[model samples]
Target: MANRATGVPAPQLLFDGSEEKFDLWETRFLSCLHILKLKETILREPDEASDEDRWKNADCYAELVRLIDDKSLSLIRHEAADDGRKGLRILKEHYSGKSKPRIINMYTSLTKLRMADSETVTDYLLRAENIITALREAGETMSDGLIVAMTLSGLPDSFKPLAVHVTQNEDSVTFAGFKRRLRVYEESEKMKMTEPTTDNVMKTYTRQGGGHSKPHSNRKEEDANITCYKCGIKGHKARKCYKKVWCNYCKNNTHAESLCKKKGGQDGVRKVAEEQGGDQDHLFKAKYVKSDRPPGNVKMKGIMVDAGATSHIVNDINKFQSFDNSFQSETHSVELADGNKCSGIAQQRGTAVIHLLDNAGRQHTAQLRDTLYMPSYPHDIFSVASM
Candidate 1:
């Protein structure tokens, strides 16, 4: 091989190969390359840069630089005016249609904004306190959740006193750590106020005579105070007297009978006869029998009737069955005193008559005008003859 050397390509010349011109062009090209390389390095770095560092980067500052370069600053001024009008409209709508929940959400959002460094905590607290005060003056009761939220948003303990009476014991835990300790003392005071005392427990049993005497238990004492009419004593009723008097209806002192002259005397005898006549003259008079035994007997002296009752009733149905065997009618039901019903016979009275003799041996007849039914008498019998 021959000893020949390869040559390098010459640099493309700019501005006609004068020394000053070439030097100036070379400097400009190298500076442009350096600026591009710096931009690439800044873009490749993580966004963990501080605000000042980000502002210093030429690529990030390019928008401001372009705004300064362009003579269209009036466009920026017009956009700012439009944004202000939009903000005013939003504020008006927010204030006009806001509900309690919306207000609370707005307050929470503001608190969060302040926490994130978009607003001052003191300003947020002042605005929130004004809202809470207005709500209290409007007679609205705030919940524990709202109070806790306010406290967490940097509201002071001075606002705590405003809600003291409204707060419940269970809601005390929702407050800040220092406020909860004060709430424990408040609860203790409430407990002391509600506790029962010994004086109140004994007040009910201290009345005048009620403590010494109960009603049924003091019956003997009550009887001892009753005045006796016969013997003229203070300790006994008239029926319990020891002295005895002559029979008012008889001449004898031992007993009184129907024929006794003392009973048939001028004044007493006439009075008795007139009373008996008045009893017999009543349109409806019946005898009611009373006994203190089971399967009791009741003797009916007159016709037993109830014109006011809806159904016919005759006591002692078995007694009338022997007298008129064919007097039986359809068996109907009647209610007894114990709430059970009894089956009985209903009969038509075609001139049903009852006869009875008075104490003077004078006979009287009682007439019936309607149907009568007889059921078994439970314990009492009412009769018209007794009148």
Candidate 2:
């Protein structure tokens, strides 16, 4: 709007009594008055002003009435007609967030804002934007770097890496830049979860000195399509060719006599001793496989392949993809490898994420079902018996 007398443009910003817009409107209104050489009319009292100043004050009061909504105008309408300074003061008290209590409340809300578990980064940032805007409108001098810090402080541990990246560049980065980085990180995490995972290779061993044996069932029809290299058999691999191996105990060409089921008790012991060429102690055996990935920054301490364990167990609860806290029971207990037992009062069972190496020896994520929680256990145990 242009002034009819001075031909100067009046402040275009109108205040509709909105708390967030009051600060901007007031600033622009003051700037417009300064440009028109009428700021003294509102900033000075009537008694201290001259005839020209008084006339200018009246004009300024009229301009204020024109720039505000009915609700805001009503706040200063009853003031002295020429004393625009008093009217402006009345409006400032009502619309400006200068009150100590109001500013305190806004700061409190800002500090308490947190990102919920199911909330996306965009959603959380939007929610934070509202509070930050309110605080700034209240005359609080919150800097962009402080706002970024507050946003990162409210996020969960899953966003820790992203938070660190943003913090390191806080001096050079804008809040908008941090938000874009967060979105990219979130998308990458989602992609990692959806992609197919390879299963890890696990090898197990028996405590006793015995090798795998083939099943005894051998029908002629089953062997028709198969051939063995050792004995030219039609149904099995050379290692399982029973026709080529003689069993001294069974006294037959169908199988090895040492593997003969008829021989039991001391004979089995004698066969094992003969094969080893000496006596052997019956001891538990287990193999723990370390991930091929770089060990310096590995999250998991280690995974042990326990040939004797009856169930898979993990020490870290965060590794579980799905968990059942209700699986905990006081009656349950776990016996350690050292023959010590830990109470099951705090134990829980769930499906857990287990890192594994595929056939190609590449690291991949895999899930293990019915895994037991053993916080006191020294190492994560993958059970052959459980499999």
Candidate 3:
């Protein structure tokens, strides 16, 4: 654009090629000459040059730049003895990193970008943005739309819904705007995880007697007739109900009040210390397995191999072919990672014999010891940690 007052174009910034960045500098110098319409004069034949003063003006501008940029002056002192254009060309050939391996590395980095499973959207966006910036500096032109699409596509599978939301938006997404949306989506997902779900509310009510308890077939007909005093639900006896006898001591439900590791409150729904199966003097931590799945009956198909568990567990007590029902009225609970405990569990005193085939197709028999049984458990957990 020409200057309105002087009818001459505004001067362009001079480059000294600091940090060995000659590609960018060279482009700027060439663009300045083009903008001033002096590039044709410098490229003209000797006869054409004689017809115009463009070549002379281009040379004068280059020399002025060389003088103003101290770094350029020292590098071109010998090369540009007569014409500044020669000095500029040599400077570009010497310092331009176009042929360097860094350009390939930058492209590789951009292509390999990924969002880790544990990485938050905010952190991943920063990582992708840095890669995009490096690619741009290496002369790669990535549009904001491409960046938005790539970032959304590179996100972990859990963000598929967010990706859909982005694609479904009517408004064009700026890179900055997409980041804000990503952050909002991240927060929403976090809230969803923390908030109580419908199933959780249903379970809580079912356990508290506000909802009907699923009947256990082994429970006595008389016991199942009336509501349980412990859980305030109809279907099972107080002894059979899985409602946890909250323990005041140890701050967990791992044991009933009577079986608490420490002294507990007396006014709650649990039996007194002396009323529990064992003598008060013998109260101790029971052996049971803490599993992720709830109770159900599915035979061998339900078995789970879990290294995180300290013991093997089965959800259905009846599935145990040789289960010892010695502690029929006794309630044993398993401790969870969240510090809560579930009461529908028991430590088995018997063994289970498994008949299987090895890789050689030969039949093999294995016996498991002290397997746990939880009448309410859904999956059979075989703990490698225990083995």
Q: Give me the candidate number with maximum lDDT.
A: 2
* Colliding residue pairs in candidate 2: 226-234, 247-256, 247-257, 248-257
Prediction-by-prediction clash tally: 3, 4, 7
Candidate 3 ranges beyond 4 A from true positions:
1-16, 19-35, 39-54, 57-69, 81-85, 101-387
lDDT string, candidate 1, 43-63, tens digits: 355457555444434332332
CA-only RMSD, every prediction: 37.4, 17.7, 16.4
**TM-score of each candidate structure, all chains considered together:** 0.17, 0.37, 0.30
Q: Tell me which of candidates 2 and 3 scores higher on lDDT.
A: 2
- CA lDDT of every candidate: 0.38, 0.63, 0.54
lDDT string, candidate 3, 196-252, tens digits:
652221011112245643423432543334443344455544434577656465444
Name the regions of candidate 2 deviating beyond 4 angstroms: 2-12, 34-47, 104-387
lDDT of 1: 0.38
- Candidate 2: clashing residue pairs, number: 4
TM-score of 2: 0.37
Per-residue C-alpha lDDT of model 2 across residues 319-364, encoded as one tens digit per residue: 7778776565577766544233446523788888766655566667
